[model samples]
Target: MKSKYNFQVQHEDGSVFDMYQMGIWVESFHIYSPNPDRTFLEFPGKHGSYLSASYMKNRKIKISFQVETGSEYELDQLKHSIYNIFYTDQEFIITRDLSPGNILYALQNEEYDFDNITGEDADFNLTLTMADPFVYGQERIGTLADDAGYIDYNGTAETKPAFSFDVLAPITHLDIVSDDGYMRIGDPYTVEETPFEPETIILNDNMNTLTGWGPASSVDGGTVAGQMSVLNSNDFIASDYGSGSAWHGPSVKKSLSQQLQDFKVECYFRQAAYVNPKDTGRVELYLLDINNNVIAKLAMADAWKNMPKNRAEVRLGDTSNNNYMVNTSGKTDTWWNDFQGVIRLERIGTKFFAYVANITRDSASKHFRTWFTGFDDLEGKFQGKVAQVQLHLGCYGTDSAPSQAFQRIKVSKLNQPVTNQVPYIALPGDKIDINFKKSEILINGEERKDLKDFGASFFSFKKGRNNLFILPEGRVSTTVTWREAFK
Candidate 1:
C-alpha cells in the first residue's frame, strides 16, 4: 500500500503555499535522523574519556514529486512557479499532514533535478537543509503559569478552546521635565546635608548647675571635645517648679523668598541622663515658623518601658497648640549615645508632610518616620516669605534640667518628590511622541544627542521587546502598540 501525505511550505516572505493544490503530486518524502553528532576526548593512558559533547549539525530532507500538464504552456508555468520557490537561498518552513504540529525550518540545499520531462508530465527531485536540527511545534508550550492566568482544563470554553485576554495600552508620547524649575511635574528634590553652626546662644541656668552658654560653658556641643553650649535648667526648688531650665541656640533663618521651598532641621544631641521614672521630665526640640510659632516639635524622654531606647516622640502643630502626634510609639532609636536626629517638613501643594528620624547612629537602619499633616495656616501665611527655625531645650514638670547638648545642627532645604526623572519602554513598530525636545530624551541609558524633535525615530523594537525611556518636563501623554513575534 502507498502512503499519502500533504505538504505545506511557508516562504521567507510569510506566504504559505500548498504543493498538492498546485497540481504537483508528492511521491515520497525522506526525513533524515534528528540526533546530533557526539564528540569524545580520550587520553592515551586513560581507559575512560575525559570529556564528551554533542554538537547539532544541520539536518537534511529530500522530496520527490511529479507534475503533469496537458500542454507545453501549462507545463512551463508549473515548472517556473516551482523553480521560483526551490531555487532561492531564502529560508522556509515545511510541514507534513502526518506530523500535525511539527514543523521544520529549512533552506534549499541542492539543485533541483527534473527527470522524464516531456510536454505533458515531469518528475522532480529536491533536497532541503534544515536551518535548525530539531522539528519545533507550531506554538511554544510553557510549563509555568503566568501571573495573569493560564488555560485551565476544568474551565468551560465560551467559543474556542484557547484562553485570551486584553493588555494595557502602550505608552506613546513622553514628556521630559527639567529639575532646575521651581515646580516640576514629578519630585525634583535632592537631599543635601548642611553642618549646624549656631550664630547665637542663650542659656538660663538659674540653678547654677552650668556656668553659661558658649564654647567655654561646661557642656559638650561641638564635634570636638570641650564645653559646648548647654541648655541646663536647675530652677528646681525644694517643693516644685513650673519650667525648669531653658536653652535656645542661635536661630538659622532663611528667606522664604529663596527658590527652595522645603526645609529640614537636623540636630545631633545626647541626653544628660535618662528621664526620672517618677516625674515627667522631657527634652523638646522646636521648629518655629516666621512668627516664632512652633510648627513641629520633637519630645524625647530618657527612657520608656514600652518604647525603644533613645527614641524621641514627634508632634505636629501651629502656634495655637502642639496637637497632632504623628507616631505614638516612635520607632526611631539609637544604640549609641551620640546620634543625629532629622525633621523634614515639605510643603506639597496646599498640604504639608513631615518626616522625622530620632536615632541615626546605625548605618543599616531605616528609622525615619513620616506623617501627612493637612494644610497649615501658618505655611499659607508665610508662603514665599522668610521662615525662622530655632532649636530649643526645656525641662518640664518636677524633673531637674537634664543636660541636653546639641552639635552639628543644620537647616537645609529638601527637594519635593523622591525622584524627578522616570523611565519608560517602547516596543517595535511603536510611534513614540516625546512632548519634550530631543535634548531631554534618554534612549536606554545614553542620551541621544542627534534627536532634535519629537518626530525622530530614535528607537526600533526588536523581534521580542524593546525598551525606551524619556524624562518628562511637565504633563506627559504616551501611547504604544505592542506587537509579538514568534519563530
Candidate 2:
C-alpha cells in the first residue's frame, strides 16, 4: 500500500502550490541520512589510528508521485508544471512531516524518471538535494522596526543563527526579542570600555533655556534684551560693564574628578559693534583647574599699538604667573566687527591645540580665515584636570561695557567610539552575503576596508546576530539583504 502524505512546494519567488490541487498524489517521500565527511591520521609510533572530527555533508531527498490528467492538453500542462519545478536554477522549500523542519533543496543532478503514460496518467519520481542539511523553521527570527533604529530577534531554535541590521542614525538599539532577554546596545549616552565618552552637545541653546550654567558677572547672564546686540536678529549672550570694571561676560563649568583626559571645547562670538582703538579691550576664553588657575587662554586683543591693529593670540598660563603666547597674528578690524568665528580648544596628552576660524557670510562655503596655535607642558601646573570653562569679555585700557554677543557654545570629548554597538551574529557554518549601497559603512566602529575596493562583502554567520551598521552620508538610503544557511 502507498503511504499517504501531504506536502507543499514553495518556489524561490514566494509562490506556493499544493500537490493535491494539481491532481498530483504524493506516494511517498524519503530523506537519506546525513553523510559525515571524516578523515584519519596514522602515526608511526602510535598503536591506534586517530579519527578527525566528522562534519555532516549535504543530504539527499526523493519524492514519488503520480499525475492524473483527463486530456492530452491537460497532461501537457501538468507535465510542464512539474518541469517548472526542476528546469529553472532556483531552490524550493519542501515541507514534510518526516523531516523535523522545512528542508531547503533544489533539483538534484537534473534527474527525473517517469513510467510509461497510460490514458494521460503517469507515475514519476523526482530527486532533490538539500541546499542545507539541517531543517529550518518557516518563520524568520528577526525584525527591522519601522524607525529602523530598533532591531529585535527571538531565538527560534536551540541553535544560534547569524543576524544583521542597518543603522541610519548615530545611536541605535539592538535587543533580544525574548520577554526576559536583556541585551541593549548602541547607547550614545553611556561610555563603555572606552577612554572618552561620546560627543555631547551640552549647550545648543538658541536663547531658549539658561539653567545649570553659572551666573553672568558684569551683565545679566542669560538672554540679553535689545536689538543692537543681536546677530542675524537672534538673541545672544551679551556683556555690559560700567567704567573701571575689567571682566565681563558669562562662564559655565563642569566639575570633573579626573574622569576626563582629553577634550575639545568650542564656542562662537562676535563684537556687537565697532570699538575705539583705545577703549577696546580683549575678548578672552579660558579653562581653569579646581583651584581657579588658568590652564589655557584664547584671547583677541584690540590694541592700536599692535602691528596689524587687532591681534588674536593663544596663550598657555600656569599657577606661578608663568604666561606666554603660543601664536599671534594680526586680524582686520572688519573681521572683528563681523567676527562670526569658532574657537576650538583641544587637549591631548601634554599638548594643547587652539583653532580660530572666521566663518564666511555664506555658511555653505567651507573656505574660512583661520589660525592655529599649540603648546605642551601646561598639564603639570593644573594637576592634569580642567574643572571650569570661562568665557570673558574685558576692556584693558578703559572700563566700559563691551557689546559682545556669544552664541552656539558647545563642548565635546575627542577620540570617542563612533558606534558602540556589537555586531549581530550568524550561526556557525552559515554563509551570508551583505551588500551596501549609498552608505558610509562602518563595522565594529571602524571603517570596513573590504567595502572600499568592492561593493559587497560575504560573511559566514557564526551562530549569532551579526552586528552591522550603515550610515547614509547624504540623501542616500541604506539597505542590507542576506540569506541564512543551515546544516
Candidate 3:
C-alpha cells in the first residue's frame, strides 16, 4: 500500500492508471462533508422552524494533480494521454489508499480543466458529481431452497440485489412474498417437450445439486467425474459434498452396462463460462471401458496446441481426425455458439447415433443426427466396447476441467414425458437470471420482457436478516446476489 495521498484510477475494461506509475502526484483534494436536505414547517410568528424530514443528497468531489516529465517529448505525450484517460464520456472508478473497501464511481461528466507546461511539469483538476448518496461494497451471494430460507447479511444500509432461479420443476407462476407485497411473474408460458419418448433411464443426474452415486463417491479426489463443474448462483459447489447433503440418484454400474443394448446417454447442460472458443480447459460427456479407457466421448476443446482452434466433436477411438471435429466439424458451431439443451450419443441395437439440440430464434428443437453408420466406419469400430461401459460426465484425469455445467442427464433407451406438479413460472432445466437493479430478466441467456406481469415491480432487501417466502414452491431453488450499501 502507498501513502494516503496516492490514488488509483481504474477503467471499465480493467485497465488501471496509478499516480505513482506515471510520475504524477495528487496535489490536493477539496471535499465538503456530505449534507442532507431538510423539510420544515413554519408556524405563524414562530421563532424557529419545525423539522419534518431529512434526506441525504449526492456528494460533489474535486481533485488536483501535478505531473512531472523527464524530456520534452515525454511531457508532450504524457499530457495527451492524461487528457484522453479522464476526458472520455464514460464512468471510471477512483480508489484511494485511505478508503480500502469503498469505490468512488466517478464520471467525467462535470466540468474539468487541464493545463501543462512543455518544459517538464504540468497541473490539472478533475471534478465529479456522484448520483448515489451512499458508498457501495463488494457483492454478497446467498441461496434459498423453496420459501424457507435464512441467511446472514452483513451490511449497514438497504441494498437492492439481483436474483437468479435454477427452476427444478414445472410451475405456473413464481411469487416471492415480503412485508410490502409480493414479486411475481403473471404472464403465460409454454412448456416444450422432448422429440422422442424416453423409457427405463439407466442413469440420471440433475445438476441442481452435487450428488454422484450419493455417499462414498469416487473420481479424482474420491468424488464424481468432471465434478468441478460450475454454475451461476448454484448452492452446490465443489465443497458441498458428503453423506449429509448427498442425494439418492441412479448410476450406471458395470453389471447394468453388460445387459444394456440400446443405451442413450443424454446431457442437459449449459456452458457456465464462454469467453471465446479457446477456453482454459475442455468439457466432455464420456463413457469408459472396464479398464477406465475412453470408449467414446463428446468433447469441447481446442483442437491442438499448434492450432488452437475451438471445436465440439464426438470421438470413437481417440484418433487425430476424430479429435479435431471429424463428422461433428460443422454441426457443433451452434453448440459452440449457444447450445440450448441435450448433447446425446446412444447405441440403439447395433447402430450408433449422435444428436444435439439448440435454440434458434427463441425455439429449442433436437436435431436427430448421426455420423457413424456401420462397424467398417471409424466410429462403428468402437461398437464392440459399447456394451461393457461405465458413465462419466467430465474429462478423464482432468478433475477441474471445463466450465460447462450439467443441468439434468437421463440415460434411457426410449424417452418418456413427465408432467409438472402444477403450472409454474419456470421448471426443471429452466435457468433464469433476474436483476432487480436493472429491471431485466434473462431466460436461458435470452431477454424475456413478455413474461413480466402487469404490475410486476422491482424491490430491494433491507439491512440484516430478511424473512421472505416463495409461494407455490415445492421443488424449485433460487439464488440471490447483492452488493452491500454503506452511508
Candidate 4:
C-alpha cells in the first residue's frame, strides 16, 4: 500500500545521482528531464507497476509518469493524471507513463539495467512416480454347475438305472456377482496347445470394456473369495479334450485393486494352435485410470480397429508397416509365436508420456526398447489424478472366438529418494556462520566460538567431511539444502 519514487539522474557527462521523491496530492509524479533517455526512475522490489514514455517535441523535453500502485481503476486515474499534466503545460505537449514494457525497450536499446538486476530466468520441473509397485493380475475361479435342483431330470426310473440329468444352464451363460458388486461373465473360451503341449487360454473377447477381472470367486463361481470370479453365458465344463475348447468365454469385469498410477502393463501371448499366421489370435495390454476411463490399448496387428487419427498398426516385424521399429523382432507373420509387449506409462502432471516396446524370443536380439505414442491429455489437466490401474489380457478384435490368455502380472513401488550432497570449498581455519543464530564453530578440531549457545552460527568442521550442519525447527520448517562456504 506504500509507494516510493526513485530518480536516477544521468547528466550528459558519464555520471549518476540518486534522488528520493514522494508522490504529490494526485498520487502521481511529474519529472522534467532535458534528455528523456538519460533520466529515468527505478522501483524497489517487483511491483505490478507500468511506465508510459513520451517525449515533448515542442519543448525538447520528455514527460513520463512513475506509477507506484496500479489496479484497473488506479491505472485509469494515472492515465488521466498524465493527460491533464500534458495538456495543462503547452511546453510539455507530449506525455505518457513509462510502462514496464516501454521501460524494457529502453533498457535493451540503451543497454541500461534500470532495476540493476543480473539474470532473467524461469524454471520448472516435471514430477512423477518414477517407479510404481509392479502390479500383477489377480486370479479367481469361474462359474460351475454344482448347484442342486438346478438341473431337469429327464430320465425316467423305468429305464433300468436312472441317469443323472444335466439340463443346467451352459457355463457360457454364467453370471457371477460379488458382494462388492464386481461382476464377471463367462464367454465361449478358446484353447491353444503349444509345441510343448501346454494348454494356453484366450480370455475375454466380448466384454472388452472391463479393465481387470472385477472380484475373486471360487472355481464353481459359488461365493466371493479374496479375488473375483468371472461370469459367462456358457456353463463350466469339467473335462473336454477333443474340441480344443475347455472353458466358456467370460465377460471381463474390472477389479478395483487392479487400479494403479504410473505403471507398466505387460502380457505374454502365443498364437492359437491349428491356426494360420494370419489367423493367429491376438492379446492386448491396456491402461485405465480410477474413473474407469480407457487410457490406452496395445495389441497385435489384427486385434484392433485402425484409429487412423490416433494409432498405427502393422504385422509384427514388418518393416513395410514402418510404424514397427526396425528393432522389433519376430516372424513378420507367424502364429503361436511367443512374444511380450510392454507399455510403460509415465504420468507427468496432467499428461502421460508412454513408451511401447515389443520383445521377441531371443534375449540377445537387438530392438528399440520403446516407441513414441501421442500424449494423453487429461480431462481435468490435474497432476496425480490417476489412481486405480489394470492390465488387459484381451482387448477385442480376436480372430479366435474368445480372447488371448495371459501368464502373470505384477506391480511394485520404487525406493525412497536419497539426499543429494552439495560440495563447498573451505579452508582449514575459517569461521562459518549459519543464519540459524546458533553460536557454534569448530575448525580443525578447534572451537571458534567461546560459548556453545550458538543458535544461528555455522558449524566449522575439519577439511575432510565437508558436511553442513542444520537444525530443524518445526513441522512447517523447510528442509535445508545448502553447502558450507569455503576460503
Q: What is each predicted model's overall lDDT from 0 to 1?
A: 0.44, 0.51, 0.55, 0.27
Q: Name the candidate that leads on TM-score.
A: 3
Query: What tens digits encode model 4's per-residue C-alpha lDDT throughout 5-64?
Result: 333333211123222222321224333232222334557786654455633221112212
Q: How high a TM-score does candidate 2 get?
A: 0.40
Segments in model 4 whose C-alpha atoms lie over 4 Å from true places: 1-261, 267-280, 301-338, 362-370, 373-403, 412-487
lDDT of 1 by residue, 81-133 (tens): 98777755667878787876767777887777567577778998888897666
Ten-residue segment with the worst summed lDDT in candidate 4?
A: 103-112
Q: Write the per-residue lDDT of candidate 2 for residues 249-312, one digit (tens) a residue.
A: 3344444434345777776666533444334545556666677666666666554532224456
Q: State the weakest 10-residue window (summed lDDT) of model 2.
A: 219-228
- Stretches of candidate 3 exceeding 4 Å from the true structure: 1-3, 7-24, 29-31, 43-50, 70-92, 150-156, 170-173, 186-430, 444-446, 471-476
Per-model TM values vs. the true structure: 0.34, 0.40, 0.47, 0.26
Off by over 4 Å in 2: 1-168, 171-208, 216-236, 245-259, 272-279, 305-308, 318-327, 330-337, 363-367, 396-403, 415-487
